[model samples]
Target: MNKLINRLVLGSALCGFYAGLSNAAVLEVQGEIRPDPSNPGGAQIINNTPVTGYCTEFPGMCGMLNLRSNTFNISFHSSGSIPVGHVIPFGFPATWRTFTVSHSSIPGETAEIQIRIAGVGTRYRLSQKAQEIVGLPIGMDEFYYHTTLWGASWVEATPPCRPATEWGRGADANGTDFTVFWLTPEDVTTCPKSPRYVIPGMSLQRLDVHYELRAVRPEKLIGGNYQGSYTYSMGSDFDMGSLNASDPSMTFNLNLTVKQDVKVEMSADRVYLAPKSGWMEWITHGRKPEKLLGDLRFFILSSSPFKMDLNCERPGIDTCLISNGSHQVPVDIGVSLPSPWVDDTGQPIARRPLKLGGAGLQNIKPAGLPNHLPSLLHFAVPQDSVKDMQSGSSYRGTVYITFDSDI
Candidate 1:
């Protein structure tokens, strides 16, 4: 082993949890990575928001709301249905009416209220935010904004339904919470027009909505909070479905928050470096060593993009140097990361140089590693530099390795 001492520098800028505003509260999600047993790498995005902004706004009518590490589902809002031959007021908006019969009607104050969910392609911004990281890969099959949730229990259907659109197919095929690729935003009614009975005690103006979020691969994203929201315009001239309330539209916002954990552990508590094969080849054969090098093993578990850097103790010394009795020699250092971790060009890190005071390595990202893996730290004194060493000389060095997850 090459004789050397190792030092580790780890850091994290964990963001504070944000509470959702009254009815427009933002959903917050959180997750993390560590050496712990149950959830080592923090590969999944978990819910952190205490409450759903939109769900709280519509207490009893929020059909179902589910928030998990991989699976996301919620009911945003729904609207009342137009009775057959009910007037279709196109250019004008109207308020909901609470027409009541005489209080003489006692026990079963029954009212079968019909409601419908309109087909509206609403776009939303989904993100994983950190101080250094910005923007996320949002797509149909990608982690961020995946296909719209369809074919699930949340989206209950009735009779007299139309064919499903590119995004809401499952709504037409009966109903179940499923997913469909997102497409153009079209304002139309794609759900069954059949009337479903409403509980007798609830307000006639009660509204509802049903939707779900696709699984997000937090392992492939920077560790942080991922918040998302979309507002739907109600009424005959707006989006999603029609709202019978006097208000033109009730803005419903759904937010998704994800928090991720990250960490790095050293396998070799302290480092010791020497010639290859310990000192056997040099001492037994009386041959001088060509170079002095050592490899340090480390376990890395990160759900965020990061960068690496190097520094030396007692700076005014030789820069990247080792000194003994007023003499110092320059040494070299490098890093090698395991699979699923790559550079800017998407290549595995191997012997990447680390200059003492120069810009350190950057753009270190996970290509989707779901587990903690081993990495190597290379410290060496090349042949050119090793030749200057005196016989029976003992040299020691102290260097610091920094793993920054800010990026």
Candidate 2:
């Protein structure tokens, strides 16, 4: 905390009400005239009665001067749903005549000033009034308050029958002297879930004061109090900017290898609609999925490019078989599909035709004779190249699946 000085009050004719023999005198102390509640969002402030007890001047050259009148000004919250007000306890000496004096010494200094009310209690009393005025809202923890001063004055001089530098060589004897004081409270930690005090009209909150005393003579001593300000915002959302979104870049690619004689295992990547027993159909109608992966496509290499055939039959002597049609479906380069009619090499009959006991006796084979495989193929399509092929290649193509929809 740094002390800022801009002495501007005009010098008035000194009154000898309780005056000593000094031509000039300087008296100073730090204090704040904080409002009741000291927070805006907690509750409205209706009334506040502050009692300030002055301390005795240090036992230095300026200690001999008698006291005079003092002024007190209270400022209220300025924004939010609650508007602030101002009250001046002017001519306070005439109103509250009990401004007394106590004493305490600076650790290493010979001088000592009287003790006033403790910082916490002074603000606590004001808070009580604020809460009483403002109805306590849910989640609110404190009310708002602020204060200022008027008619502040001081001088520099020697006491009656005493030398100008009576205290010591450092005594004023006409050297520059100045003092400023604030009536504030100690720093108190706020509750975590407590509603913040927003400045009345502004978006700022939690204003703090950092103060220090700068000594041009003797030693540099600095001290001050930090309390909530009613005129400033009391929340953390004061000054902010913008936000951002997450855009992910994903690349999908398919590796197709025409192995000489590869043994590949096939399994369902997704239980899409499950396998149906008889004629069945399905239709999907909804928003396009972000990502979809189909089943694996397995097949063996043929001397010439050709389409694989599909067929199926019930195990045992039931003779139940799929359509007797031999259909051909195109297989892009390097794609593979398993065949059941032939041996492991796709060239030898593993089982004869099943006996249906009817005119369809052309296929009469035992249940699991040698190998009558299932009519399912798994393959991985080159997804990453879809965009590239669509952009760099020209096409005059129409593709179709071997199984057509009955609908």
Candidate 3:
């Protein structure tokens, strides 16, 4: 009579951490991805920096940047000082342009940064004011009172800098926000060197910037700390429309770290092996058991693609062995994870053989995060091997299962 004599146990380890870069006057942007039971998304972007120039006066614009989950915000804080030596005021640079950012840690990977909206405060003073200042049409003064003559009523929606233009990015402002004109992106052609740049002595007091980042999705990349940076010329380019200003440009450094949160909680760490039903028929009727089987139940939550490694106390050529005082036998192990957790090719992991060197569990990502989902670790002894075991002999061995995401 063969006895049900095998017992299996469980254990775990983690390898992940967060990282960032530091510099003075180099505007830094940081974000992270941590395990959260409530957040169903892959990663959540956080706004670490405060909104100084825009948020205070332009609450509507600040709210717009935060409306999207992926949109991030940062403050420049410093104003562009008009240079004293430069005599002529250059054309207000093409207000909008695309910024290409490259990853600092990950080579050959890049992302696009677009200025969704922006605001700037300035004192639009003119050397002379008269009936000529009244050249701007009367009906143009619709939304905000444009105090100066060159740009009378910017509140009127049209031409460029209007909040409703397609390429204009909903970026528009009247002179109402304390002498600040809010606008999107437009080059020399649309908003040419007309009344826009005809001013004599104006100084930029504040410049606020908001950006929409098209970063590489977390699912497509492995887990680790990644960083990137983008520098913008503060002249007539998109970032800050100052043709002649004190600060020439600013650099935005992005840092994103993800500590792939992989957890396994065992409901029953230890399990005792038995024939399909029990030892009753095998003991009473002397019938040879078809197969010996047992299983360990667990709950798992892996935030990124991960692999599992297997180890043994008694190693065999292709498998592991369990032994009693005099006899030895081979045991096979497998695993099954529930829905939303699939292999690299999007297939289910049902009874997949758990090999000694992590052959079965490699590059498995989730359609949705696995939130403590019920799982099983299966152990089996083949009938062919069980027939050779001594009757009433108890065999013992341990199998180590490792869940790793650094792969």
Question: RMSD to native for every prediction?
Answer: 20.2, 37.8, 11.1
Number of backbone clashes in candidate 2 = 47
Q: Quick one: best lDDT, which candidate?
A: 3
Ranked candidates (TM-score, high to low) = 3, 1, 2
Residue 48, model 2: Cα distance from true site in angstroms: 99
For TM-score, candidate 1 versus 3, the one ahead is 3
lDDT of 2 by residue, 25-134 (tens): 11123342111112211211111222222211222322343211121221123223322322111100001111211112213322111222111100111222223333
Model 1's C-alpha root-mean-square deviation from the true structure amounts to 20.2
**Per-model CA lDDT versus the true structure:** 0.39, 0.19, 0.50
True-vs-predicted CA distance for residue 63, candidate 3, Å: 20
Tell how far residue 6 is off in model 1, in angstroms. 7.2
How does candidate 2 score on lDDT?
0.19
Model 3 TM-score on a 0 to 1 scale: 0.54
